[model samples]
Target: MKTLEHIPLNGELPSPKGVALAILELCRKDDATIAEVARIAQTDPALASRLIRQANSAAHGGGRPVASVTEAIMRLGMGTVRNLALGFSLVDQYQNGPCGQFDYQGFWSHSLLMGLAMQKFSNMTGAGASEELFACGLLAQVGRLSLATVYPVEYGRLLDGQDGVARNLVALEQEHLQTDHNELTAALLGEWGIPGALIEPIYHHEEPEHSGFSTGSRPYQLVHLFYLARRVADLGLAGENERNACTAELLLLGGRIGLDAEQLGATVDDLVQQWRTWGELLRVPASALPSFAHMSAAHAMRDEKSDGAAALRVLLVDDDPTTRCMMEGVLSGALGHAVVCANNGREALALAVETQPQIVVTDWMMPGMDGLDLARALRATEWGQTMYLIMLTGHENEDEVSEAFEAGVDDFLVKPVNVRTLRARLRAARHYVQLLEAWERDRAQLKQFAAELAISNRRLAHAAMTDLLTNLPNRRSGMNALAKAWAASSRFEQPLSVMMLDIDHFKRINDSHGHAVGDTVLRDVAQAIQQSARKDDSMCRMGGEEFLVICPNTDLKAAVQAAERLRRMVERLRIQAGETEIQTSVSIGVATREVGMTETDALVNAADRALYRAKQAGRNRSCVVVQGQMRCFP
Candidate 1:
C-alpha cells in the first residue's frame, strides 16, 4: 500500500469554547466551591437549559420540578453535575453541521443506546467506568463527522460507495488519510487536554482485541464495552443479513466476556427494550430503527436450527414378524422416519449400511449372527460413525451389557421395551446426532473464518507496530514480543534472550546520501537482521536505526553467537540507492533471562546496559550481559 499524505490540520467546526472552558475550569480545582462551579456553568444559557431538562427527566427521578439553575445544581450531586456539564459541552461541540451524508440524529441515538448498554454492563460487572464509557461512545464516530465537515469532497466520494459496505471505515480512513478515526479522536481529545486513560478507548475502539489493554485494564475494558454496546445498538438499525453478522460476532465474543447463551439472550432482550425507550427520548423515528420484534424472530430461527429435539431414525431388527411390525409402528407412526426391519444379524448389517439409521433396536437372541455380532460388524465399518446401536437383551446381567458395550452398542433395551423408555432413548440419540453435526459444521466454518480474520488482524497489528519504510516490527511490537517472551520464559523456567542492535553513524549515512538512500540502507539492514534470526525469533525495528530481537529457549552463549552473526550479516549487506552503494555495520547487545528475573523490564534493562557497553567499546561488535556485568565479544 502506498503511504498516504497527512491532511492539513487547519479547519474549524462549531467551537464550544465557552462551554468547554467552563467545564475544564470547574474540573481543575479541588478547593473550588460548588456554588462557584454552578456559577461558571450558568454562564452558558444553552447548557443550563439542557441540564434543567435532564434533571426533570425520568432517568433522574427528580419529581419536584426545579425552576432555577441554582436549585438544580443543589439537587444533583457534584459528580452528576460534572457529567452533565461534560455531556453538554460535547453536544455543543458536535450537534450542529451540514452533515450532508451523515445522519446526526441517528448517530446520537445509536450513541445513546451504547451509553445505556455500557452503564448496564458496568453495573453488572462492577467495572465502574460508566461516565467515561458514555462519553467515549458518544464521541466514537466523531472522526467521521469531522471528516465530513472538514473534507467535504473526500467525504462525499466515500459516501458514494457506502452501500452495504462491511469493511471497517477507520481502516479505510487510514488508507486514504494516513490517519484513522481512533488516532484522530485521540489526538483531538489530547489537544482538548482530556486524561490519557479516557483517550485510550477513543483511540483503540475499532480493534479492541489487539489494543494491548487487558480486560482488567480499565481503559481497554471500557472500549470493549463500548464496542459491544454499539453492536447491540446496531441490532436496532441493521437489516436481516447485517443483524445475523452482528449476532454471530456477539456470540463469538460472549465467551470472552463471561456470558452464557441464556444470559446473552436476556441481555439482548433488555437492550432492545432500552433502545426503544431511548429512541423515543432522542426523537428518532421508529421507522428508522431496527425493530426488536424482527431481531427476536431471527434469534429464534437461529436457535431452532440447533434445538436437537427433532425426529429420529430407528432400525428395528428381529425375527418375529409381529414384534417387527409393532416396533415399526412405534418408530415410524409415533416418531418420524420409516423403520427398516431385518430378521437376522447378516440382513441387519446390510440394511444398517444402506439406510444409515441413527439408532438400532435389535434383538439379542436372533437367528444367524445375533445382535452382538451385528453390533460388532457395524462398529467395524463406517456405518457405525452415524448409527447409535441399542441392543435388546433378554438377560439382565451387568456382564451381558458390558459385552454389548464391547461390541459398540450405545445402550441396552431389555426385552419388551416400554414406550416411554423407547421414546426417551430415541430423543437422546437424536440430540447427540444433532449436537455432533452442529459442532462439526460450526468448527469448520469458524476455523476457516478465524484463520482469515487472524491474518488480517495480524497485518493490521503489524502495521500498528512496525516502521512502514523499514518494513520491520515497530517499537510497540518489539516491546510487546519482548515482554511476552520474558513472561513465557519465567513461567516455564526456560532460557530466554534479547538482543538490541543499532546501526553505526546512521545519521551520517542520511546526510552523506539523501534520505531516500538512507531508507534503502535501513531496509537492507532490516533484511540482513531478519535473515540472521531463526524463524521463531522476533526481529523488530525499534525506531530510527535501532532494532530488537526476542529469542525464546536461548541461553547467553547462543544469544551472543546469534547477535555476532547478525552484526556480520549487516556489515556484509550493501544497499544501492540511485547508483550509490552504501555499506553499514551494526553494534549488538545480548541479554539472557537469569534466575529471579521475572519481569520484562529487567531483561530490557540488562540488554540496554550491554548495548551501552558495546557503544563504549568500538562499534560494530556484540556485547553480552552476564551476572549483572557487561562483557564485550570480538
Candidate 2:
C-alpha cells in the first residue's frame, strides 16, 4: 500500500566497497572470459585462496584435484566463477560490528542455507539456472543488512518495535528514507549492472506481486525460494510458539509447491543437515543457527495436532427430529465439532447468523424455508461468502446437483448419508477452508513466488535445450524432441522433417547495437520462429542465434515449404528500439528422414550441411540436404 519513494535508505549502513569493486571489475569487457576473470580474481590472494578452498569443498565433491586457478575456472564455468568472486568479496563486508540487532554471523549462515536450498531445489525439480538462483538467494536479504549498516539507529528503532516489524519496517523506511531495502538493493544491483533476471528476485523478494515481473517468471520463483529458505531459518531460530507458526507456514508453502507431507518432511531434513554442514564450513558459529532437530520435532507435533483436531463448526438442519439427533451425534461425538441443530430452513437461517459455521448441512425439503431457500439467503449474507453449503437430497440426477450448486450449495449429501461419505465431505471442506485462509494470508507473496519460480524453472529447462537471450527451447530440448519424434515416426512408420536456421550476421547486429539490444532482436527472431513452426513441431534455440525446427510427420517437400514460410516470417520481423526499427533475416537448412534410419544425429547433421550451403550461396535463402547433396532454393 506504500509508494516506492516513501521508503528511505539509512545513511549509516556500511559501504559495500569490496562488493561494488568486485562487481564493477567483473562486469568490465576486459574481464569478459572466464580465464580473464579468474586472472583478475587471483590478483587478490585472500579471495584466490577462498575460491580454491570452496572449489575443493565437499559440496563440489572434489575427488580429483583442481590444482590451479585455470582448472577451477574451466571446471566451474563463467557463471560460477563470477558468483564466487562476488560472494567472497562480500564475505568481509558483514564480518564486523553489530548492525542494529542483526547477528551478522547468524544472518550469513541463514543466507548460506538459503543458497544451498535453492540449488538443491533446482536439482530436485530439474529446474535450470541453479547457480544464478543460488547467487540471488545468498544476496536476497542484503538490503536488510544494507539498511542496518547505513542507518543503525533508525534500523534499531524499526527492530525495537516487536508488535509489527514486518508492517512497521515498511512504514518507518518510507517515512524517513523514501526507500526501503528492497528498492535500494535493486538500485544497487542495477547500478552494478547485474543481469535483470538475478536483480529481479533481490528487489522483489519482499513484495513480489507488484514488482512488474510476470507470474511464472524466474525471479518470482526465486522470491518464493528465498521466503521458504527464510522460513526454514525461522524454524531453526524459533521458540515453541514461533516453531508452531513456522510449521503452519511450511505446510502451507509445501502445499503450494505440490510437496506432500512425506516429501516436505524429507526436504526439511535434508535442508537442515546441509545448512549445518555449510555453517561449519563457513566458520559460522553453531549458536547462531536455530536448533534443527528441536524445530523439526516441534513441527511434527504441531502437524499431528493439525491433522487430528476436527474443530470445524457445522450447522445441521433437518425436519425429522430423529435425523437431526443422529446427524448431531455423528458430528459431535464422532467427528468432534460444535454441531448446532435446527429443525427447518427458517430455524437454520437464524442459527447460521448466530453461529457463523464454516459448513452448512441441511435437508432439501424442509417445512417453512426449504433447503434451497435457506441456501439462497445465506449466499446473500456476508457470512455466506466462503461457507461451504451442502444439501441433502434423494435426487441423483445431474440437473438436480447442478441446480443445487447454482442455488449456492457446494456439495450434495444423498438422503441417508453414510458416515464415511459425510466424514469425507467434512474433511474436504476443512481442507478447502484451510487452503483459502492460507491463500488470503499470503496471496501477494505466493502469487509472485509462483510466477518467478515457474519462469526460472521453465527458463532453466528451456536453457538446456535453447538459447538464453532468445527465450527459445535450447538444443537439448531440440534433441529430446527429435528423439521423441524419431521414436514416434519409427513406431507409426511416418515421415519426418528437420530444419536448422541461422540469423545472418548476428555478430554484426550485436556489434552495431549493444548486446542488450541484440538480445532483444534475438528474442524477437526466436518468437518469429516459434510462430512460424507448427504447433506440433518442435523449435529449439541452438547456441548463438542458430535455431532448429523439427517437423514431425512431414516429407522433404513439406519441410522445404515450412522452411520458406519461416524465412519469410523472419524477414517480416521489424524490431523497434526507441526511434530505430531494425530489420533482420534468417537462412534455412532442411533435411528429411524416410525409412530405415532411426538416429537423430544423422538427420541433424544433414540439416547442418543444408544450412552451410544456404550461407555459402549469399545470405537470406533456403536450402535442402538430400542424399548428402545440398540444393539451394530458387
Candidate 3:
C-alpha cells in the first residue's frame, strides 16, 4: 500500500464529509472511544438513524434492535462503523461528480450490489463479519471514483476514447493518468485504517488470477469472493443482453468456489433483494433484474436444441456390484451418457482426476471413501470443484441428508435408485453442464469485464459442445464405460475385457520407507498409469495399490498386449527418492467377457481372482483367466 504521502494526487481524494468526517476524525485519535465516535455520529440525524437501523438489520440484529447511536456503534464494531461512514459520506457528496463520461449513479448502484453480494456470500461461507465485508464491498472500487473526482476532465476523456476495443481499464487509466483506481482505492482504504487483509483482495479483485495467493487459502477465497461479488454487481447493472452475455462466466466463478447453479441463483436473488433495501437506505439507485435462472435460460435457450444431443461423461460410484450395474444401465443405456464406475470413493477420486466427468453419482455408504467424503474431496479440487455430485443413499434420515448437502453433495438419490428421480435430478445437472459448456465455448468472445461502457459489445457465437477437458489423470463416471462397452460388444458381437493392476508389495514399501517416500512413489506410479493408458481404456483405482482398467472392443490377446505395455511402463519407472531411486512394479490380472456372460460383475470378479493369482504366482507378473482355464505370463 502506497502511503498517502506518495500517491501524487493533485485534487482532493474522496473522503467522508460532515458527520462522517467528524466520526472519522474522532475515531482516528488514539484516546478516542466508541462513545466519542457515537457522540459525533449522533449530531447527524440521518447518519445516526442509518447506523442504528443497520445494527438491527437481519445480519446484525438478533435480540432487541439497537435504539441509540452508541448501541449501534458498539454492536457493529468501531471498524465497520467507520468504514460505513466513509462509504455513505462519499455517496452523499459524490452523487453527481464532474466527470461527464462517468455514470455516478450507476457506480453507486453497482457498488451497492457488490456490497450486498459480498455480505451475502460472507454469511453463506463464514468468510468474515457481514457488516465489515458489506462495507468493504461497497467501497471496493472507490478508487475509480477517486480518479473521477481528482481528474474529471482527463478521466472522462480517457473513458470516451476507448471506442470499444476492450482494453483493460487499469492500463487505460495509467496510460492517461499516472495512477489507477486500484492503487488509489487501496491507499484510501489504508488511510482510513481498513485492515490490509481486506484491502489486498479488493486491490486484486479485478483480476484475482494475478493475486498469487495459494489455492484454497483464505486470501484466495476472499479475492475470488470479491471477484464474484463484482460479477453480481456487474449483472445487477447490466442491460439484458449484457446480463445474458455474462451469466455463464458468473456461474463458473461461483462454481469454482463450490456453489452449484441452483445455490448461486438463490444467493443472487437474496442479495438483489438486500441490494434494494440497502439502496433505499443509502439513497443510491437500484433496479429490478430478472432471476438468475431466467438469465441463464435466456442465454442458453437458443442452443437448447443441442443440449441433450451429446453424450455426457458421467461418473457413478456404488459399493454394491448389483446397484452399480443397475445405475450404469440407467445412466448409460437409458440416458445416453458415457459412464465411468467406481466401487468405492477412493477409486472414484482417482478416476475423477483422469476422466473429468461432468456429473458424479455416488452411494452414500461405501467401505473406503463414503459418498459424502467423495463429494467433499471432489469439491476441494480445482477441476472437480464443479462436477455435479449426487448422493445415492438408502437412509432417509433428514439430518443425514442435510449433512450430505453441507458436505457439498449437489443432489442425492434415495434407495432402490428410482430411475425417474435420478433422471429428474440429472436433468437439472444436465442443464447446469450445458450452461457450463456454453461458457467454455463463448469465453473467448466475451470481454474481460463488463463494468464500463467502453467494454466491447461483440456478438457471441452460437454454442457448441466441445468435450469438457481438464488436466485429466480421468472420472468415477458410472459403469457407463463398461455398459457402453457392453452395448458396443453386444451390438457388434465383439470381444470385451477388463484388467486389474496391483502395485506389488506396496505395504512393504510403506513399511520399509516413511509414508512420504511411499506417497511420492504412489503419485509417480499414478502418473505413469495415466501416461501408459490408451484413450479407449477406462482406468480407475479399485482400492489401495490396486486399479481397474476396462478394455473395450479388445480380445484376450489384444487386452494382454495392452496390459504388457502398461506393465513395462510401470517397471521402467525409477521414482526418485531423497537419496535413492525407488523402483516399483505392478502385478496384472486380465479377464475377458466370455460368451453367455450376462453379469458385468462376473468380468470384474474374474479380474480380481486373476489378480490374486498374479500375486500368488510371485509378484510382478501377469495372469489371464479365460472361461474356466487360466494362463500365466511372467
Candidate 4:
C-alpha cells in the first residue's frame, strides 16, 4: 500500500546497482522484450549465472535446462527477471554493511533459505511463479537490511538490546528509527513496481490476522504463505537448541496447507539442500542443519514422554555387515526403537512385507534390487505408500539426490553419516509415525460420528457437481451433461455437438500481471461464454484456461457458427484489474456426433483433437473435424 513517496527515511535506502540497475531501467519500457533483458543480463556474469541457475531450478525448469541467457530470460519472463535482478542487486551490495549487531552473513543465509522454501511452497500450492516467489522470499526482509545499512550504529544498538523476548520490533523501530521495517519494505517493493496486491500481503504477513483479507482470497493465502516461509526460514537459521521450539509452530503452519509430518519434513529437507547450493553460488554461509523430521520428532518425544508412544519398527537394509550391525545397535540400543536388519535389497523386500515396518532405512548400491528399486517396489504396494523411507547414499550431487527422492525415498543421508544427524532424521520418522497413529484414531472417531450426517448429502452433492470459482459446471458435471445430451440425441435422432475452447497465451497474462488478474479474466470469460450460450447448450470450466460447451440439437454447421460467435465474444472482452485492462482471445475446436459415433468419448475426443488443430493453426479462431476433414475458421 505504501510506496517510496510515502515512506520517510533519514538516509539513502538500498537500491539496485550495476547491470541490475540497467536491466531494471530497460524493463520499465512498455515494449520491453526478453531479448533486451537477456542482453543486459549478459553484461553481468554473476547475474547471468544466477538467471541460468534459476531457470533450471527444479520448480521452474521442467523438461530441459536453458543454456543461454536469452532462453533463461524467456523461461523466467521479463517481470520475474527484473524483480530477481533487484533482489540480487540488494544482496550483492548489503552482504556486509556497516551494522555491527546485525548478523549480515546469517541474514543472507536465512534469506536464501527462505527464498528456496518459498519456491518449494509455490510448487506445492501453485500459488504463483516459483521463481518470482523465490525473489520475493529473498527480499522479504530487505527492510531490516536497509535499516542496518542506513543507520548502522543506531540499528546495531537497537538489535543488541533484543534479549530473546517476543516483542513487536516494528513498534520499537517506530520509537527509535521513526520508520519500521514493514512500512519501508512495502514502500521499497511498491517503488520497484511490485503489484499492490502482493505488496499488501507482504506488508501484513507478519500480522496476517489483522490483514482483514477475505478467508479464501488470493492475498489471504499469499500473506499466510509469506508467514510460513518466514517461520521456516527462522527455523533453518536458528541455533540447534532453538530449532526444536520453532518446529512445533512450523508443523501447525504446514498442517494448514495439508502437509503431514513426514511430507513436510521431506519437503523442508529438499529445500535446505538447495539452500546450501545457492549459498555456494552467492558466497553466503548456509549452515548444515538436521532434517526437519529430526527436530519435529525431538519435540514430540519431549511432549509425549508420559503418553507411552510406541517404539518404531525400523527395517535397516545395508549390505555391509559392520554398517548394518552398527545401525541396528543404534536403533535398538540408543534410540530404543525395534530394529530389523537385512543384508541386501532382496532380503529387505522379503523382510519388509513380513514385518510391515513403520520405517525403512536402506542403503543404495545393493545386490539384485537396489535401494531405489526396493523403494519403488515398496511404494507400488498399498501398505508401503504410508511407510517412512530414508535412503543412505555416498553421492550428494543434485542428479543423484533427485534420483533417490524420485524413486520414492522420503529422505536420504550422506555416506558415513553423523550419528546426531541420523538420530535427528529418525526422530522425524518417529514423529511421522506418531502423527499417522493419531490421525487414524481421529479418523475412526470422526467416521463414527459422521455416520449420522446423511442429511447433508444434497448440499455436498451440489458442491461436488459445481465449479467453486466460476459457479459453472465442473469437468465431471460437463461430462455427465454431455452423456445425457448424447443419449437424447441417440433416442430422438437429433444432432449433438461440443466445443473445446482454450484461452490462448493465458500463462503470459498471469506472468505479466498476477494470478489475481488471471482469476478476474477467467471469471469474466466464463460469464461471457455462459450468457451467450444457446438455451439448450451447457457450459463448464473444464480447468485452467480451458472450457467445454455442449450444444444439443445443433448440427456441425450450427456448432461452427456458435464457436465463431463465442470466439468473437471472448476477443471483445476487456477485463479490468486494478489499473490494467486485459483482453484475451480463445481458440475453439468443435465436433458434432456422427452416425458412426457410438460413445460420448469418441465425440469428446474428436472435439479435443480439433482443439489441438486450432491451437496448432495459431490460436484466436475455431477448427472442426467433419467426416474425416479438418477445417479452420479464421
TM-score leader: 1
Residues 1-634 of candidate 2 have per-residue lDDT tens digits of 2222444543554344553365346656654776666676677776666556556644454468686777766666666666656654565667655554766776677677777677666655544555555666676666667777777766777767645455467777767756676776666555544566677665655555566654566666666766676676666655567776777778777776788766877787777776676566556643343444455576776774766436688999999998889888998998887788998888888888888898898999987899999999999987687888888998688997888899989999897889999989887888877787777878888888799788878856655655657766677777888899999998898989999899998898888888888888888888888788787998888778888899999999999999999898889888886688889898999999945555888888889988989999997999997777779885
List TM-score per model, in order: 0.55, 0.49, 0.50, 0.50
Which one wins on lDDT?
4
Which candidate do you rate higher for lDDT, 1 or 4? Answer: 4
Model 3 lDDT per residue over 501-595, tens place: 89988888889887887777767766776778788877665546777788888999998988888888999989876787888999999999988
Candidate with more favorable, higher TM-score: 1 or 4: 1
Worst lDDT window (10 residues) for model 4?
A: 451-460
Clashes of each: 3, 31, 17, 2
Candidate 1 local Cα displacement, residue 273, angstroms:
5.7
User: lDDT of each structure?
Assistant: 0.72, 0.74, 0.83, 0.87
User: What is the alpha-carbon lDDT for the whole of candidate 2?
Assistant: 0.74
- Candidate 3 segments whose C-alpha is farther than 4 A from its true place: 163-167, 305-634
| Model 2 stretches with alpha carbons more than 4 Å out | 1-69, 98-100, 125-128, 162-167, 191-193, 252-258, 286-634
Error of 1 at 398 (Å): 14
